[model samples]
Target: MYLIEYLKSADSLTIQLSLTLLFVVVYIIVTKLTDRIIRRFGRKNEIALPRVVYTIKYFRFVLLVFILLLLGITWDISFEGLSVYFLSFFTVAGVGLFASWSILSNVTSAIILFFYFPYRIGDRIRIVDGDNSIEGIVFDLNMFSIVIKNEHGQKVTYPNNVALQKAIIMLK
Candidate 1:
């Protein structure tokens, strides 16, 4: 048949289109599976709504990065060419924003807190910092820091890194 002959002679655009569809299918399946796992784990652990939402967002961001990398490879984008572009951009970013590496550390801390942390929101906790100890109710936690409301009704923003490093006493 003419249709069979045409199919046997797939063009470059046809090949690219097929590959794109394959990648999209894989991405969707992986994303859905990961999302279900996160939600199930969150429910089992009784994680707060805000915490669960943020965790999902973080995971989706990672998946997006992976998909973009795959897209580049599928399109035959030159990594050698990209290396030159990224090298200069990263060099400048590294010099100007080197001090902000703590932000990444905080993000790592946030992930740790999301899973292994013992306390939940609304639990009263005291961080032992010698005489300058902080006693407050756990308020909110995000990508950067954990918020706490002290007894005097003041909100304290504690860096996630410090929160992880210090000793905490659960008051409630």
Candidate 2:
């Protein structure tokens, strides 16, 4: 009887705590699942462990932001306040980030290429961009760009974003 009375009296707080715990549990489970999938895919593709780890770190950041939003809602925090803060922050940061948005795109593309790109280092491939087509052996893959050495021994650095946008022909 006393426990029931206490629970009734603390209903709001109890519900809030329960929801927070649930969110944390769910977030943990999701993180583990994603990490497992990433590792499995990386192993299957022979991707470098460092690249897989970096991808997992990026995923964790996204998950953290989602968990924060979930907790905020559970606690009845004001969305308007968060929106205003983020608006101001992004507005100020956007200027600089926007100027170099291509860099960001390259990084994103690099992550995608890490897992799904069929061509690997030493693979001979051709990028079919009319008037700018490139045929080369992939020399290196970096976060920002792919370095390829052509038949003439000319080294070309192609941005990851552009690589993804262009059609690739696997010569070998």
What are the lDDT figures for the candidates, one per model?
0.86, 0.89
Per-prediction TM-score, please?
Answer: 0.83, 0.81
Winning candidate number (TM-score): 1
The number of clashing residue pairs in model 1 is 0
Tens digit of per-residue lDDT, candidate 2, span 71-100: 998899988878999899999889878988
RMSD of each: 3.8, 3.5
What is the C-alpha lDDT profile of model 1 across 1-172, one tens digit per residue?
A: 9756865798867867777888889888988998898888889988887777778888888988888898888788999999999999999888766868878788889888988888888899998988878899989877788889998999999888888999999995
Which runs of model 2 end up more than 4 angstroms from their true locations? 1-10, 151-155
